[model samples]
Target chain A: MAVASSDTAIRTSRITRAFIYLFLLLFALFYLLPFGIMLVNSLKPLSEITGGNMIALPREWTIEPWLSAWSTAQIGVQPTGLRPYFINSLMMAIPAVILSTVVGALNGYVLTKWRFRGDTIIFGMLLFSCFIPFQIVLIPMARILGILQIAGTTPGLIMVHFVYGIGFTTLYFRNYYAAFPTELVRAAQIDGAGFFQIFWRIMLPSSGPIIAVSFIWQFTNIWNDFLFGASFASGDAAPMTVALNNLVNSSTGVREYNVHFAGAIMAAAPTLLVYIVAGRYFVRGLMAGSVKG
Target chain B: MGFLDIDNVTKSYGAVEVLHRVDISVEEGEFLVLVGPSGCGKSTLLNMIAGLEGITSGEIKIKDRVMNGVHPSKRNIAMVFQSYALYPNMTVGQNITFGLEMHGTPKEERDKAMKEVAQLLQIEPLLTRKPGQLSGGQRQRVAMGRALVRNPDVFLFDEPLSNLDAKLRVDMRTEIKKLHQRLGTTIVYVTHDQIEAMTLSTRIAVMYDGYVQQLGTPKEIYDSPANLFVATFMGSPAMNVLPAKLVERNGALHAVLTGAEGQEIALRIENAPAAYQSYKDADVFLGIRPEAITDPEGADRNARNIQGFTNGVTVTEPAGADTFVTMTLSGKDCIARMRADADVHPGQPFEFAVNMDKAVLFDPKTEERIG
Candidate 1:
């Protein structure tokens, strides 16, 4: 009986290991293919890219597109470069991400651990507001911003992004806070930690994942936003997203695909860098918050 | 003067009352336990005393100072929650010294207190480990140590041992009892586990339906419960309450019980209440504890009259040390405790004795004690 059992165990271990290796190899190919194609296409000259299939590597690669995207390029009569738009996007996304996440964390701390009236109703409204499309309110939102008299500035875009970004950030933090054992909060309270003390010392340090998630989401939303940025910002205050759109879809100009693609990559760079730096926190945040809710 | 006094405390959520008019006073160095079933308002009362919850219409005093609106830290009370409530992100040493650090104890004094508490709890070697890295028993000791370092006016525990495993719970229970004896501080503990109440408390307050049913020493509460609720709530396997008829026999009161074989047994009741004297031929409930009823040939048969009450066993369950025998008397079910060597068998009826002198009688309609 012992001999037969040992043989069966050995066979089972081998079979399971083989299955795992096969599964991993298949997933590796699935992920690496698209990235490889995007790299090759980005490096190739525009003539080579449009002449051949995307899978082929370029015989001649040039850095002119990358350099041009960083310097002077214009779609309108008044000449201006993409540099200011890149800086504007940076100004909008970073502050929007930071303020939205800070507010979300505070809101989460109040709603979950503190028992007060109408907390559930407020949370439900926040979640409901996140689901509404931004286009539905863009016109009214633009008028409101205009009435506030800060329509064509960086701060106005930051405020608009923060307002739209709060719903999702709160949803992330609130749901993450719910998974925490409430006993910890009570213990902090008993330890003489008042509202801000508990939030800053005990709760926020352990809140790395949720903060990363909230930042990434807000960063991407603000960086990639075109309609709001276009409606709320004009002239030199417009973000890199609108600048890249003008480069690609100009009403009547020679469309430079290389500069537009490079500019597009630049516009998407901030969120992508954020994702790389906080990659583990982002993954853990998704696993912890999204899986539960 | 008493160390702590709770004056006519009452709690209600909206229209439904959870705790009703509870008054208790604890002498210095006393260990008091409030025990009941789920939703019995024991935890609510403890929370109010801890200043974690506001009192609806009551006042709590610690060291002669009224503590109604005071915050928990200002009240000088430390509570150990059932969940241990350790800061998960903190090490054992940090958790123990958090309360001290908050109260502005100097750095050297805080370290001294941490050393003393860690040594007392035997958690010195676990100082660097966070709560999640420790075992359940270790976490429990750290929780106790957290409360110990404060040296507060009072210690409140809300079912702190309910989360431990069975063997750990027994070990922790003894440690808590020993700690009370050694430290001589005021403690108010709440639990639904009756054995914890019976073994650890200087006094046990039995609560039910938002009211204190009875308050007395452990022996007093066990031997002389105030009502049916107290009698049934305090014992393991519970007290056997059988329906019977009260009657007058030879100018004395007796309980008339009919056995399964249709035989009538006349059990003499001593010092019967005046209300029961007029309850002749009236249906009443007979409350008898398991220990009060014994085997016909048990050792305590001579000290008390083994014939004061008698019943026949219907089933017997031998639990290694003692046997529990279920019997039917007057068409009502009751349990009796017998020796393990009694040789009682299931489905075989055997004669058993009941100590009517210690039995309590309750009115069937109101479920209240006759006396």
Candidate 2:
């Protein structure tokens, strides 16, 4: 975007630009150093990693640890792998992200366009809920889960993440829709459209950027959350984070460092994929809701 | 009751009332303009009529049906908003017929109605283009087309042409007036531009500070204003108001004021209203339009009493077809309109003609017209 600007700003010498680029490149490589070490040690046998330098390239590359981490990594006294937990995380994150985003969009529509008495207070309370710590709700949530008799289930974990995530999603959507002209809603109402019809036709079509922002935010938070997963879910219902913790801890004596690296990378892979795919819209959507009057 | 009636309608947000007892009745095909400065409750009144804002008191009826507690969509009324309010995601054709589709009209019929409206608006070539891609004028046409496609009982226009440039505003004003003439649909338009109100409206309701200062035909509002507010608000170079005293000389009513040189000048008033008989020696406000005072040669030949006076010009502004000459009368800058070629300059004494027949008198105490 800056390259297209024909503005006459202060000019910099070639050597200065070269030094700036070199500094940025070095900082980037420094951040990537841990990931580089993890990647190089994940492919070698455990014996080689123990005897050799961890930063060095693989002496003998093999897929045995990858296969072991995916299946047969002895996760919690059972000869199971992180694959089922990965699937559990996906199932939990997908529905929770979608439900929270949709409900938040509805909340945003009503708060901005169809405002009623005490709406600002309701929105203020929703925003206040976002700052609440997860530990504060653990006891009450556990009690509710027990009463509902679905404690430690995948649905229960999804419910926990969903209940906690809607506040943030609503905040994003409300600010974004605040800048949307209220005249369009009034015009639609006069055009014989009802409440939900206006929302579906007039509003949702232009909500692409904000929805992308909400989806990326909710997906990242719910997938990376370990506290809620460990507390609300158990056994085969554990998310990938809990399963990976079990895989590393349940191993006795000789630590399979190579398999641990593989399992850790596997747990972080989905979030990495999400950011790589939709990260461009994160800043764009945030800016859309920020700079508008 | 007329076709659309706003009967003693008042809108209040809690304790503060923005609109107070707005009573306007429009016969079929009558174009009533609700015009005022911003925050004068003109738009609020338009919204109340459109059913967008609920009325706190009184009632609004369309086609003689009471519209209280009725939803906007069920009111069968259409409004063209100030921003145009074209749906950004829909194309021109779809935007035009969205209301019809929402009403469960068949696909083929919706398309037919859309085409007819597009043809009427001469936007047939732009049907597939989205609103973001269209120019400002074209988007305005599509907005009007959207309202026209519905064929509702009453059309409410809330400053629709204000978003355009100066030239486009004039052009669209003409187009709207033409549309009203062709369709003969009852329209309640709102605007702050007084010229639009005077030109397009069959009757103009001039508002100020949440009060309807005056309501009458454009000519009536121009020639016979109800108060000082209407007289000053309805004209471009607003009607000049000079403080004067009403006196009786030679057994005829006369308005006596000071000239530019501080000399006493008296203009005889002929055919005065009966109310002036009681205001013999009381102070009064004399209102006269710019065009009513012109060069001796440019004065209206048909005027019954064109009184000539000599005043020193303080300013001369050449405005193409007419030259506006300003001078001090009764210690106020009184403007006189003359032909562009009138040899007028500042610091020069010139003979100006005043058409006393067109002059209006207001009571100094109440500011209301004397008769």
Q: Please report the candidate that would top lDDT against the real structure.
A: 2
lDDT of 1 by residue, B58-156 (tens): 888998999999988888888899999888778889889988888788999999999999999899999999888988899889999999999887899
Give each model's clash number.
0, 0
Cα-based RMSD of the predictions, in order? 3.7, 1.6
**TM-scores for all candidates?**
0.91, 0.98
Candidate 2 per-residue C-alpha lDDT over B75-185 given as tens digits, one digit per residue, 9 for 90 to 100: 888999999999999998989999999889899989988889999999999999999999999999999999999889899999998889999989999999999999999
In Å, residue B280's CA in model 1 sits off its true spot by 4.3
Q: Compose the digit string of candidate 1's lDDT tens values, residues A45-88.
A: 78876677868887888777767767766644444657878898
i-RMSD of all predictions: 1.3, 0.7
Off by over 4 Å in 1: A1-38, A46-55, A72-81, A249-254, A276-280, A290-293, B273-276, B301-304, B308-311, B347-349
The Cα error of candidate 2 at residue B143, in Å, is: 0.3
Model 1 lDDT, residue A208, Cα: 86
